[model samples]
Target: MVKRQAYQPILITDASRSQHDQLRSRQLRYIVMMSIRAACLVVGAILVGVKPPLLWLWLSLCGVGMVLIPWLAVLLANDGPPKEKYRLANRLHRSQRDETPPRSLPAEERPHPVIDAEQ
Candidate 1:
């Protein structure tokens, strides 16, 4: 198994308050889901024999929790705040190549490929 790393920053001060709150809540959501999953396991074990039919229900619930919790937890935990969305797009670890803006051409000067190709 690969070891996980805390590579991301917890909060960016320059970001908006909403983004900070969103990041904080995202981490909390993962913790809550994980706690629920653990509770399912503990309750399932305790109820395994005291109620046999209900055991199946508990096990099914546990199964679903087990399957979904880790994946969703990882996703939520790894998710970045909304403000970073556009900034991250520009910093894709690509080499320091020039990303100059495209030269603008006036509507009249711009090539009308669709118009010309139809001829």
Candidate 2:
């Protein structure tokens, strides 16, 4: 008698986001960050003209925002989704399995037929 394996249901939660969706999200994030940087520049210019009480502090904050936003935005835009735990585990398991020495059959165990060279 043969034993049957249990059935497993496919779960939608296991699926990763599509490339197009991921790209769109990243693009939106980058745009928002750049917009913030532009706002910082405008605020800095306004601060320069108005000369507020804490003029130096406000200008320094805006300058920092303008300088940092682009660097962070670029880094985030280029970043890809992290590998799933099961995916990493499977890769490691596969590599380890491949590295194991292959078994070889003894001469007698290997199939061979006599070759007649004098025929």
Candidate 3:
């Protein structure tokens, strides 16, 4: 089984607030669907009885519920700020470093005498 990894922050400068809200809403919808599916399975089991055949079905539903709950907690539960996104972006920036020298300033612009970097 592949172990799940924690989410890393990878902030995209272009991401808009509306996009974030839309993603949050979709996550909430998944949480609701999983909840309803679980309820249906439990009520169905109680109404019809957990026989040998139904036992396997019940177990399967329980397994699905187990998986869904954690995912819902991670994706939909608002955790105040998006720290993960920022960290991820930093990691990406670090991996893309190049050692080229910076472009020289234009000849028309003289260096300001008051600004001393040699200090």
Candidate 4:
């Protein structure tokens, strides 16, 4: 397992520890998936050997998992974590906010005065 720094964003394409960590995480998931697949196969085989006809349907399902798991694992292993996503609020600095228009628009925009003069 790799340690990530406190502040910096991890670039998906960078050849850094962050990318390697992402791959490691994915491999860990694949390991769990494959472990479960193997367990299913073993159990299915055992049941089939004891009484062949009864477990045939289950064994077929296990075979399907055996065939598909490797393909899925390879695809997952190649996948990288998504690039850092910063929202509008997080991206803009307080200084930048000063440049933007105020909450209230110009008086001309509203036909009626927001505050009535008569009290």
* Per-residue alpha-carbon lDDT of candidate 2 for residues 38-112, written as tens digits (9 for 90 to 100): 999999999899998999999999999999999999999999876566566764676566542323644433323
**Between which residue pairs do clashes occur in model 3?**
9-84, 9-85, 9-88, 10-85
C-alpha TM-score for every candidate: 0.48, 0.69, 0.35, 0.51
Ranking by TM-score: 2, 4, 1, 3
Question: In candidate 4, what residue range of length 10 has the lowest lDDT sum?
Answer: 110-119
Off by over 4 Å in 3: 1-13, 19-27, 30-37, 43-57, 60-71, 79-81, 84-119
All candidates' lDDT scores? Answer: 0.63, 0.75, 0.55, 0.61
Best by TM-score: 2
Best by lDDT: 2
**What TM-score, to 2 decimals, does candidate 1 have?**
0.48
Per-residue accuracy of model 1 over 2-60 as CA lDDT, tens digit each: 97632332333333445578778887998898998898778777777578776777789
Model 4 misses residue 68 by how many Å?
0.6
For every candidate in turn, the CA RMSD to the true structure comes to: 17.9, 15.7, 16.1, 17.7
Displacement of residue 6 (Cα, Å) in model 1 is: 48
lDDT of 4 at 97: 46
Residue runs of model 2 more than 4 Å from their true location after superposition = 83-86, 90-119
Question: Is candidate 1 or 2 superior in lDDT?
Answer: 2
Higher lDDT: candidate 2 or 4?
Answer: 2
